[model samples]
Target: MAVPVVTGRHARLVRVTHALTTLCFLALVITGAEIIISHPRFYWGEVGNVNTPSLFDIPIPASRPWVNTGYGFVMPDQNGWSRSLHFQMAWLLVFTAFIYGTWGLRTGHFQRIASYYNTAQRRTYLLVIFALMPFMIWTGLAMSPAIVGTFPFLVTLLGGHQSARTLHFFTTLALLLFIAGHVVMVIRTGFRSNVRAITVGGDTQA
Candidate 1:
């Protein structure tokens, strides 16, 4: 059987989506890391304060470490900016993902991509797109006070805000792992050819 080539339209759409997603995801990851590092602890329940015992401590710089008189390392509080940019990028991700998903489904783009890959790869892609992404989004919203106020059930469904926060952290780790694997696979398959195909709708041989 002959290998199928990605159509021009599909390639263009994939390229655009990939660029948008990469930009948004990178911003989110950097900001998210800063936000998490500031706190450096995970807790469970709707209420978690510094005084309260944490479920797990990450051993990173605690927020407001400069407050301590003898603290060596000094890091300014970036939570305000990080939190703002995180939400902004998150919304961008949501919008781009929605468009990519809708277009892929309507035009059978996913089917074509799946047909090009092995069963394991196809399954992994499906799981990431359908399961992990949605769960991550849900957990993120559950951690938001504004979102929780509008939809109390979100936090309830996740057990608590802190639980949601913990889950979001783990989900982020999972996504990083997925991205690493994806990049490795792309390089192994044929980096230049694949890049050309997606970037400029160039033809590729199987």
Candidate 2:
């Protein structure tokens, strides 16, 4: 089979969206890791606090002087900084995603891909772009207290804020795995040609 090459306005838009998504996702993941380390536990339902029985716990070492037990190892609680960056990047992701989705649909980008690519590849792309991404966005919003307060039904639909948080974490893991697999596929198909088509926006004979 001939390797697929992306070009023209569609290629340009895809490249831009891919870059923005990568940067924003990386920021979110780093910030999310820092935030999770502080609590290091997962729960469910509307209410979960320090006293609540955790569904699962990660053994993150305590850092605060009062909580320290001679062991120096600790995960820094950077929620204040991380949370701010996380939300900012999240908004950026949402905006870029909207642009990409709208343009792709209007330009028949999805149709072209579906026609050109094999069934497996087409299905994977559709699943990632349509199904998984929307679910991730929904779960992310559901976890936000402010968002949930404004639209209480969001959290209720997800079972609860904690449930949304749990789903978000797992969804993130799945996305990471998808990214890894995508990279491998690109390498196997035609790395140099793929990179040039995406970066330079021109016809590439793969």
Candidate 3:
């Protein structure tokens, strides 16, 4: 006799994972906005200065009175707190994504993947959105010259840092759109069933 699986916990995890992803996305948007505004002209490879000046041309005199001279906002320096927050949140996102993806795979989420490929799934849009994320993460990490510089081809693949930055922006937009759609769907398609599936790890009446 086979043992019965406790799906409630899984359902809860799913719900939590979605909530977390949504939160992380907002954080990413804010941090990314800071970076872009500060350094509109992005560089690729080791060609240009990555540590450009920030948009806030004002000085925080109150924060650091000990400094002798006035200072203009610098991208690398100004975003220390923002960058740290972004990195910390990104780590959470990456870790949570792994958990969610693993759960999906183990629980025959691949069936959904397959259905999308075969054009049998109801919401094929989700399949496309799902496919984009890993690629975004891969390119995002690859373009980071400071971290994981193992692959030389990455430079060419991304057409240097500038191109990577562009792609990252587009990907971010895509993620935002996906989130918007996801929220709309969750609300439109009877939130109760989704809530139950997510909270209790059990299928509801379809």
Candidate 4:
């Protein structure tokens, strides 16, 4: 009997991981937005506050009463719930990433990189996978008191806690742009087929 060959679809683990990651990321984006609105200022160095000079402002009213956004009234503070949800989703994303990474490494799945991505997609994605994502994760961890307390070097390397926070915001923006471009590419290539491939997959010969 001839062994069946799977074609067109990504690995089952990859597809499942991709789906989970997407959901987690979408949730994170929503929660992150709310968190930012609580204080839309970016800062630098180890310490910063409303009193200190902000590196930049988002040009929108803050959601917190203490932020002093120069608006007539403060928006309701969704920070508590949003931050809690954001942390939960971020950890879930990290878990998925760990599984996907380990599986890929163990199976040498990354050896098939060229087959899964085009030249442009490969380049852009490799940058995200290897560089930007790591940077974002590092900065995020650096900003956490618990994380910094244990791994002081993480914060030191980044120069300060506030620096990490500022950098994380920019990293999020870069990821958003990448996500938008990825969506556009999928639509241009064939939205339905692409979705099918990522989910149930495309045609396969057995």
The prediction achieving the highest TM-score against the true structure is 4
In candidate 4, clashing pairs total 0
Q: What's each prediction's TM-score?
A: 0.87, 0.84, 0.65, 0.90
Ranking by lDDT: 4, 1, 2, 3
Supply every candidate's count of residue pairs whose N, Cα or C atoms clash at under 3 angstroms. 0, 0, 3, 0
Whichever of 1 and 2 has more TM-score, that candidate is 1
Give the per-residue lDDT of model 4 (tens digit) for 12-68: 787899999899989988988899998889898998889999999988898877888
Per-candidate alpha-carbon RMSD to the true structure: 3.7, 4.3, 7.0, 3.2
Instruction: Identify the superior model by TM-score, candidate 2 or candidate 4.
Output: 4
Q: Largest lDDT belongs to which candidate?
A: 4
- The residue-level lDDT of candidate 1 at 192 comes to 81
Model 4: lDDT equals 0.83
Question: Residues 1-206, candidate 1, lDDT per residue (tens digit)?
Answer: 22245443335667898889889989999999889867777888777767788888775555567333234665677889999999999999999999989888877778886886689888888889889989989999998789899999998988898999998998898989999998897688788886777677676543
In model 2, what lDDT does residue 200 have? 67
lDDT, candidate 4, at 102: 84
lDDT of each: 0.81, 0.79, 0.61, 0.83
Q: Model 3: runs farther than 4 Å from truth?
A: 1-10, 41-78, 112-130, 191-206
